[model samples]
Target: MRVALWLAAEVGEGGRFVKQQLREAMPGVEQIDRRMRDLRPAGWAIMTYRDRAGLAPGELLLEKIGLPVWEKEHRSAGLRVITASTRRKVFERDGNRCIRCGILAGEIYPDETEVSARLTVGHVEAHKYGAPSGEENLVTECSRCNETAKHLAAPRFDERQVWDEITELPRKDKQAVLAWMAAGKREPSRVERVMSHVWQLPGVQREEIFRKLGRSLS
Candidate 1:
């Protein structure tokens, strides 16, 4: 709310601002950039260098202001509260792995070894205004993906290139891919499901199972 107020009162629509200004304005507030980005879902149109070629590396353009989140009636605007049950169901449905990146909860990111992935529920159509919290509309996502996905623009892939790659796959693989596409989600194979469950076990138990599986294979 403070972020919204600061943006409105200090930097009105069509105004340019920088992170330093926001940090100085909201002293001791953590993740000010993230808080500002949160406004995007509420119809805010903030453009960065990536979005606006004119913007400098450190600058932001407040193209438009969104809901009056500071106001009492609009305080919760653009935010969806997922129920505990819904979260559980969504996690289960996604095999407790991030649907976008396939990183399991507590697993170390392949690129960021120091960071362990944390799972969160996120909307499939996050950019859509008023996207629902229904199970069909939700997917399990890693925290990193959840935070960065909205900021990243869609990848530019040629339709023919994608189709050619798909066509290059074996017939069985092509069928599986088609099935996944039709379902709107890729179903985890039985081994992937079992591995996801195993990843949830205590470290010692997981190691023990790993060793047992290795011995059985031998």
Candidate 2:
């Protein structure tokens, strides 16, 4: 509600704002960023530096405001009516990483280091009719990818290019890739599991663990 009021009154469409500004407006409200993201599916166009140039890190560009969620009529525009337990289970099963891009929560994307990825639950086959909101049907996805996928606006992948790369792999590797495709989810290796857990740890703990591992390797 505060987010809606602030955007509608203070920062109108095409206005530039930052995380700090939002935090200031809604003092003591943690997860204001998440509140902002909740408005996305309702037609809000809040672009970050990663999505739009000229915006600095922590800055947000409000390209367009979709639904007036603050209004009584349109209050539930982008809200997903899922249970809290379901949300937790889905996140845990996916190891709190985006299955689409393999991006872990709060980790910066390789190409867009300025923007950190936030994990969200998304349907594996979004367009499928009567898709159940179960562990089998849901997967972890970053907010960016989830929104793009929901809108069917993801960039086109060249099948031939992808196929060529796949075909060039060794026979065992090709089979492994095929198995993952068939299952529709890639099982993480032991090292990947460790890395995912470490990525979620505090900075100090992560660094200490890395040093310990380095010593063990030596």
Candidate 3:
């Protein structure tokens, strides 16, 4: 599990830094890829670096394991990775701001175990939108902030409707919207593809679409 989490967090990202980290975990590139794929069973999903979808459940387990007893810990709990460059570049763009409320990375990622840091990158839109996997669309965030951000981005969400709530959405989601506005594209689907449409629906209505998933509960 430890090896899988570290490797997934790093390899699944698909960037030079993450690649380097994965390589360190497994000396061979092929080995690293295989290891990342293994995380699927544990609930890890290789996410786009641009949004708050990177925190696959499997990786969450790993994050819990990766905490340093002396430093604040953050788990990439629910984000996506459009591209490895997206994560690295976004981290560079906002100077690593906490996606939720613009807190600095150092503040969240501080080297204090007692203090928890919820730092993670968030995508402006979920990858289901097929949003651009580019540098102009990524942001840094703390985990708590990111999770709340991801949750708020759900269902009939409109930034204009709630300014305070917008902060709750992932930084990546904000970046994605910004890119869309900059490009003059109003097709919300184009911004986040159908994800914007899904956001338009209430959480209950959306979750009901997954009725097939209920079979597992049976």
Question: Against the true structure, what is every candidate's RMSD?
Answer: 6.1, 5.9, 19.4
Residue 131 in candidate 2, Cα distance off native in Å: 9.3
Question: Which segments of candidate 3 are over 4 A away from where they belong?
Answer: 1-84, 108-113, 126-129, 152-218
Could you tell me the lDDT of residue 151 within candidate 3?
A: 50
Write the number of the candidate with greater TM-score, choosing between 2 and 3: 2
lDDT of 3 by residue, 15-113 (tens): 323445556665644655545434322234443332234443323222222222122222232122344565667765654556445455546333334
Predictions ranked by lDDT, top down? 1, 2, 3
Model 1: lDDT to the true structure: 0.78
Candidate 2: 10-residue stretch with minimal lDDT:
126-135
Put down candidate 1 lDDT per residue, 60-132, tens digits, no spaces. Answer: 9887788887877766654545667988999988888888767888898886545678787777887465677
Count clashing pairs, candidate 1: 0
Best-to-worst TM-score order: 2, 1, 3
Q: What TM-score should be assigned to candidate 1?
A: 0.59
User: Distance (Å) between predicted and true CA of 18, model 1?
Assistant: 6.0
Candidate with the larger lDDT of 1 and 3: 1
The model with the greatest lDDT is 1
> Alpha carbon lDDT of residue 132, candidate 2?
60
Kindly list the per-residue Cα lDDT of model 2 for residues 1-218, writing each as its tens digit: 67877987899989999888888888898888778877754667787876666888888888777878787777766563345677788888888778776678899888665678877777776724334656677778887787777663455467898899899999999998888778766678799988878989999999999899999999
TM-score of 3: 0.33
- List clash counts for every candidate, in order: 0, 0, 42
